[model samples]
Target chain A: MHKTALFLAAALLACAAHAAAPKPAKPARSAADVLKDSPTSDWRALDPDNTLLMDLAAGQVIIELAPRFAPAHAANIRALAHGGYWDGLAIVRVQDNFVTQWGDPDGDDAAKARPLPAGASPKLPAEFSVPIERIGKSAGFTKLPDVDGWAPRAGFAQGFPVAADPRTGQAWLAHCYGMVGAGRSDAVDSSNGTELYVVIGHAPRGLDLNITVVGRVLKGMELLSALPRGTGAMGFYDKPEQRVGIQHVRLLADVPVAERPALQVLKTDSTTWQQLLDARRFRGGWYVHSPAHVDICSAGVPTRPAP
Target chain B: MHKTALFLAAALLACAAHAAAPKPAKPARSAADVLKDSPTSDWRALDPDNTLLMDLAAGQVIIELAPRFAPAHAANIRALAHGGYWDGLAIVRVQDNFVTQWGDPDGDDAAKARPLPAGASPKLPAEFSVPIERIGKSAGFTKLPDVDGWAPRAGFAQGFPVAADPRTGQAWLAHCYGMVGAGRSDAVDSSNGTELYVVIGHAPRGLDLNITVVGRVLKGMELLSALPRGTGAMGFYDKPEQRVGIQHVRLLADVPVAERPALQVLKTDSTTWQQLLDARRFRGGWYVHSPAHVDICSAGVPTRPAP
Candidate 1:
């Protein structure tokens, strides 16, 4: 019995010594590892109904529409897209450090204005916000801790940056660079989705919950963001010849399968995503110090090929 | 006595009536009024020594150097400019939504490298930050109240977005879109102002206090920002044929006075500036609702002829 007790004591001491000694640090993981380790359920396919493919001279830009917040605007946009309303329209506005707008340049004149194609709505209720309850239960939202002077609560929902107000039970999209919104005139409900603009500079959150944001340009932002600044007020092209003509805008499903570009977006709700965010938030090696927090707009959503 | 008391009572009643009656709202002032109202002391002309003019195919891009933050780098840059180092160089790097870089395309090869002319330094210290106390009063700072994720306090000083830490008493230029900085390799101090880059996307504040920000592109940003993205890594031109050759970069003083472009920047410290900020922060007419606060970056600095 004495020998057995002594043996147990010795084992305990050995275990304690091992715990005190430093162990080899775990190997650093690449961004790819974090995404791969994410659960399969976190991955979501792009909804064909909410996707827009803007074909440009260089390539195509994929836009993911947000109908949950801007239902009226999104519906009108869908009608316009289906009717091929913007098939040959030109990008008529390119404001430096502001926005790149596209529509019927002659829409202001009554006689020369292009009529809204059949099935397309000429008007839409400013669908800027919707009740928070209407947002899907599995939408995946992580609130940002920092204070945003523009919104009551700012964070990420699914893969997009969002703002919410519990008091009003309302939620809407926050205006970040690359975000797409419908252009309007003096009237609040003037937008019909035929005219659109994309934020290209600082996040114009003032436009948040004010205009109808339909979607975000996922890829090929350069094709639009790099256009020459217009000399006219609000970045409108003064000369009729200054506008860059659009060939066509078609849905990916409507296009031939061989022409469709294979693209994949990193799932925002996955643990891999959390790791990626953490990595961005906390810099290692050359970075002398790590930022304890990160703004939702600064956390970039990675894009690449699907396995 | 009775007459005096009656007169006093009547005057009091008139004052009370005036206070009770709602005063007519003031007329909306233009951005020009905002600058005109500013104290002359607040307005300072651009220093010819610290300014650079890059003549492009479209027009000239004026850049104001921040020597206080990057003295060593700025000095080297000034020397390079005076020596006409970039007279025959080329814009060889353009990364979409990232940066547009310009430098000697053959810089990497020791045998083919261009030699630094007289008064130019081959080596320079990484002048990323300086004492904050020297800013504003001495360095011409105009602070803005906003939450900056990268620094304790952030504001504009001498037409530049700046980040400062009161605790450490250090300040550096913030990396905003169109902001120009010297590029370097793995060595933190490798840059000698020969290679330079401009931020072309979302403000990479992560790079603040980590690099030498020389200046900002005051004009003709479209010429650089609109260039096609290079197919090589870090946006380097894969072939010599892909590079866009530089015409010349010179100080406005060096050019003939008749050739100088008439330009003026809005005085940031003026009352008109505050009014403009307020107008943008809380848009009244067209907007039904307005954001009470505005990010420092979102503020627009108008440039026009000095009327």
Candidate 2:
């Protein structure tokens, strides 16, 4: 087990299986190597209030909500989750190279849709974006070097990849792989935080501001992403049995201390994080030619075992 | 069965399910709708000479080798395919949001590795990229409006998403979702066309000139992308039973007429293709905001049920 952990650690740092590459006489240290030596202060644990745990037959999924950006949606989700609104729900959609959506499978059929528990908001004003000036004080906005096609500037805000339009003073979470958002109708304010989806493929950045993003899956994204693609409409499951059942949904705050997951995400604003990006943007190991630029979506936000 | 198809058509065209919002009286036609109206001439049939077919238990994966860019690798692959080089091999790795790699399970161990077929080339020099000027006249270089961080211009060249660095006068296939590349060791020229991996998530554009991208998966990407992620190092299956078995692989030319998949891909230079992009970029119907920009990866090359 110890040996396997060491291999996994090195593999994760490399980000690719370049283990077959012959080591140079004095191999230049890689980004993974730089991260391995990071200071303890470079990582931060999940805030229990913001962390939501989703249990499936395969495994537990970890999500860190962005209440600072979508307070109403986040709050509504918390209430619904605490009241066990989604305990027996099933994942209804898995579009290949797109998104995986889950909630009440009958969410479209109002007559059959499950009742919303009291205190859970049934509707939410489009919390598509938050003014950067408003959340700038509390949020950590670590800017990337390149300009984003979707917005004037792109970066990570409190661990979530984000795009910002400084002229409008607005910044919102980018729809990168693993991003979770409320599924909405044509109306901008239709999302009520019940039907939700997570991007499972290429970062559909154009969806920014068009959808109400809530959080991102920090772990077990594979449980959702790797599901069979539905042949039905919008990748919806045609048969009830095809849907994956949700065993339970619990906020970290509600879990007993002994049972909570031990997790910590690298601090995007830390010096270690900057070094990691530098190493990736200017890769040194095995690669013959290194690209000077890195896309915001391709730059993975590192997560590690908690302290 | 017919009802399900209609529902899927409407759902894909509508773009999303609006559970509560009033349906638009005259819903704006979407990218799907626009493509549905495209003239038959807009699409070209997949060339049997360039097409390669992979069979698995679940489905058949179709790939179109780009001889225009990586001819030597393409030629070697053709020779390997005709020799039944990949029969009974196993898909050994599935890294979530990364790639699905396949080939001989014992590839890394020379003692156990499968022998290179009688006529197959071994230790081919890296064919990472091609000069645009060399292939410029023969290939279609339909440039997108925006600049890619990795390259001065990005767009499609001969039906594949590509990036071009005008400064270097070189253009290479972008490592977008569904792209296939030769897996190699630390040595740049070590690849012998035996191991392969496909991009299953965000476009890893940084890898443009770092590795030899031989082709792109034209169909059945879901068969590979949606597989269970392996738990071992680099997402290799910890146990042999977990590996997905390959039935056979053959170039379309080697297959009889009855066995060939009838496929057509939209031509990049067609007016219909432009209209599709325009519809996606300046979405007319339900969306409140239509991004003026579209990332090269999001513009999926449309495929149709062949005539």
Chain B TM-score for all candidates, comma-separated: 0.85, 0.88
TM-scores, each model vs. reference: 0.87, 0.90
How would you encode candidate 1's per-residue C-alpha lDDT over B145-200 as one tens digit per residue? 54555566666776777877777778888878778999876566878999999987
Docking class of 2: acceptable
Q: Which 10 consecutive residues of model 1 chain B have the lowest summed lDDT?
A: B1-10
A-chain TM-score, model 1: 0.85
lDDT of 2 at A125: 90
Kindly report, for each predicted structure in the order presented, the TM-score of its chain A compared with the true chain A: 0.85, 0.89
TM-score of chain B of 1: 0.85
Which candidate has the highest TM-score of all? 2
lDDT of 2 by residue, B142-220 (tens): 7776445666667787788888776677888888999999988878888877888998988877777988999999999
- Report i-RMS for every model: 14.8, 7.2
